[model samples]
Target: MKPIYSRIVATGGYLPERILSNRDLEQMVETSDAWIFARTGIRSRHIAAPGEKTVDMAEAAARQALADAGLNAADLDLIIVATTTPDQIFPSTACLLQARLGNRGAPAFDIQAVCTGFIYALATADRFIRSGGARHALVVGVESMSHIVDWTDRGTCILFGDGAGAVVLSAGDQPGIISTHIHADGAYADLLQVPGGETRIAMQGNAVFRVAVRTLGEIVQETLAANALTPAEIDWLVPHQANIRIIEATADKLGLPMERVVTTVEHHGNTSAASVPLALDEAARRGCFQPRQRLLLEAFGGGFTWGSALLRWG
Candidate 1:
C-alpha cells in the first residue's frame, strides 16, 4: 500500500463586482493614484458590496472549485476556511460555508493567520488526508478587508480589497503536497493588525515592510532546504499579494525571475488570507501550470505569521 498524499484537484476564485480604483480613493481620502501605484503596485481592487459577507464569497469560490474538480459538496470529508473577517463571531465561516454547500456531517472550522491563513489551512487539511481521517477536503481563503479598512486613513485604506479563493484536495498515491512550513512571532503583531473589538485596520507600514522582506526570504530558503529542492526546480511561485516589492524580494531570494511568479497585486490589492489562493487559481486557470510541475507557495501576514509550501501540481 502506498502512503496517502493530498493533492489539489481544482482551484477557483471570486472577486466582488465593484472595482475600487486609486482615483476612487482620491475622492474618499487624500491619496494619489501615482503614489499608491508607486508604493504598492495596486491600481485597483475589488470591493464587496454592502450585504456581501465573507462566507458568501467563500461559498461561491467553493462551489466553483467543487465543480472544477467534478465533485460535489457531498464528497467532502472536511471543510476549512481561512479568514479574519468572518460574517459573524459565533459561527465560523467554515460552518456557514458547509451549510451553504449542504454538507452536514464532515468536520468544519476556521483558521485565522491573517494573510497566511490559506497556507496554514492547506497544511492542516494535508495532514488530515495523510492521517487517513479525510479523503476529500475543501480549503478556502476569503476576506472582506474593505469592511475593516479605515476609509479615512489613506495609508491602510489604499492597501486592501475583498475576494475569496478555494481549492479541492483529495487523497492520492503520488507526490502532491511535498512539504509545508509555518512560523509566527507574536511580538511583531502590532506591526500589522486590527486591534481586538475594532473594525479598522492599522499598520506600521515601514516596519512591517522591513520585517516581511527579511522573514519571507528566510522561510523560502528553509522550505527549500527541508524538501531537498533548489530554486531552479520550482516551476511557479504563487506568493501572497501584499506588495510587489516583497514579492520581488522573495523571488530574488529564490533566484526566480519576476516572470516565474504569479502576481495579481496590480489588480487585487492585498486580500489578506485570500491572496495566495487567488493568485494560484488565476495562474492555474490561465494554463500557466502543468501537471507534475513543481510549485512553491508562500505568505507573510499579521500574527506576524509567515509560511511556505512546496508541492507538485496535479
Candidate 2:
C-alpha cells in the first residue's frame, strides 16, 4: 500500500471591513502612530462589524476555500476550527460553521492554542489523511480578538484584529506536508493570558517578545533540520503576525532576506490563529508561490505554544 499525504488544495482568507488605524488608536488610547508603528510594525487592523461572529468569518473563508478547491461541503470528511474566541461555549465554532455550510456527519471540532492553533489543526488534519481517516479536510483559523480586547488598554487593544483563513486539504500520493513540529510549555502562560471570566488580554510585551524570538528561532532551526533542508531551499516563510521584531529575528536566523517572508502584520495586526493562514492566502493570491516550492509556516502563541510546518506548494 502506498502512503497518503495531505496536500493543500486551496486557501481563502477574510478580514472585516472596518479599519482601525494607528491614528485611530491614538484617539482610543494614549498611543501615537509613530510609537505603535515603530514598535509593532502595524499600521492598521480590521474590526468586525457589530454582531459579526467568529463562525460568520469562518463560514466566509471556508466557502471561498471550498470554491477554490472546487469541492462541495459534502465532500469534506473532517472539519477543524482553530479559534481563541469561539462564538459559544457549548457548540464548538467548527460545529456552528459546519451547520452553516450544510456539511453533515463530518466530525467537526475546535482547537485552542491561541496563535498557534492553525498550524496545530493542520498537523492533525494531515495525520487523519495519512492514517486513512479522511480524504477531504477543511481547516480554518478565525478570530474576533476585539471581542475580548480591552478597548482602553494601550497594550493589547492596538495589537489585534478580527479575521479568518481557511484551507482545503485533500489526500494525495506525493508529499503534501513534508514535516510538522509542535510544542508547548505552560510555565510561560502568565506572560500572556486572559482570565476566564474577564474580557481582557494581559501580556507582558517585552518579555513575550524576547521569548517569541528565541522559541521561534529554535523552531525554525528544528524544522529545517527535521526535513534535512537548508535555508536556501526555502522559498517563503509564512509566520505568525504577532510582532514585527519576532518575524524579523526568525528570518534573519534562517539567512533569508526579508523579501522572502510573507508579512501582513502591517495591516492585519495579529489575528491570533488567523495570522499565518491569512498571510499564506494573501501571498498565494499574489502569485508569490510556485508549485513544488518549499514554504515554511510557523507560529508562537499564548499558552506558550509554538510550532512549524514545512510543505511543498501543491
Candidate 3:
C-alpha cells in the first residue's frame, strides 16, 4: 500500500511591533532582566499594540503563507487556528481570520489546547487530508497572551510574549508525518491555567514545570518508538519555546545536542500556541531545515495538554 503525505508547502509568521524587552518589563513590574533571562531565556518579546487582535495577526500570517504557497485566499479549503486567546469568545479566531482574508464559506474554527494547540490542529488537518476531505488547508497557531497576562505578576508576566505562525499544508502522496502522540491530564489542569475571564493566567509554576519536562520527554520517546526512528535520525528537535531549561532537558533526555534544537525563546518568549510554528518558520528562514529532513515537534502547556509529531520536513 502506498503512503499518503500531508506536505507543508509554505510557512509564515507575524510578530507585533511593540517590542518589550526584559528591561522594559522591569518598569511595568518588579522583575529583573537577569532573573527572566536566567529562568526563561526571554530577552525580548513582541507586544501587540492596542487594536491589534489575534484575528489580525492570524490574517497577516495566513496572507504570507498563502503568498509563499503561490495560492490565493480563495484557494484554501479549510482554516484551522490553534489559539487560546481569541478576538472574541464566540466567533472562533479561525472564522474571523477567514472573513478577514476574504475567504468565504470554507470551514473555519479554532482549536484550544493551550500550548499544544498547533500540534493538535496539525494532527487534525493531517487526518482530514489523509481522508481526502480537504486538498488545501491553513493551520495557524496564534496568541495574544499580553491581553490576558497580569502585568503585576512578575513570574508569569515575564515568561510570555505575543505572535502568530502559520503553514500551508496540501495533500500529496509521500512521507510527511511519520508518527504522532497526544496526551492530557485534566487533573493537573489547574497547575497551569487561567482562572477568570475564560480563566486568567493562573498557575502553580513549580507543578507545571515538573509536568512539562517529564511529559515532554515521554512523548519524544513515544514518537521515536512509533516511527522506529532513533534520536540520531532527527535533524531538528523543535520543542515548545516556553523556557530554555525545558528545551535543554528534553534534548538531554533524547540524547540530542543543544545545537540541533530549534529555539526562539530568547526573543519570542512563550507565544503559547504560536511558539511551534513560529520557531519552525524562523528555522526555515535561516535555511536550517532542509527538504526531507526529519523533524520532531513537541509541546506542553495549559489544560495540562502535551503532544508530539514526527515529520519529514519539506
lDDT by residue for model 1 (30-142), tens = 88999999999999999999999999999999999999999988999999999999989968999999999999899999999999999999999999999999999999999
Select the stronger candidate by TM-score from 2 and 3.
2
- Which stretches of model 2 miss by more than 4 angstroms? none
C-alpha TM-score for every candidate? 0.99, 0.99, 0.97
Q: How would you encode candidate 3's per-residue C-alpha lDDT over 1-314 as one tens digit per residue?
A: 66567888899999999999999998989888998899888899999999999988988888889999999989988899999999888888998888889999889989999999999999998888888888899999999999988888887899889999999999888878776688888998668877765645887888888888899989988888888878888888998999999999999988888889999999999999999999998899899988899999999988889999889988
TM-score order of candidates, top first: 2, 1, 3
Inter-residue clash pairs, candidate 3: 194-199, 194-200, 195-200, 196-199, 196-200
Clashing pairs in 1: none
Off by over 4 Å in 3: 1-3, 197-199
TM-score of 3: 0.97
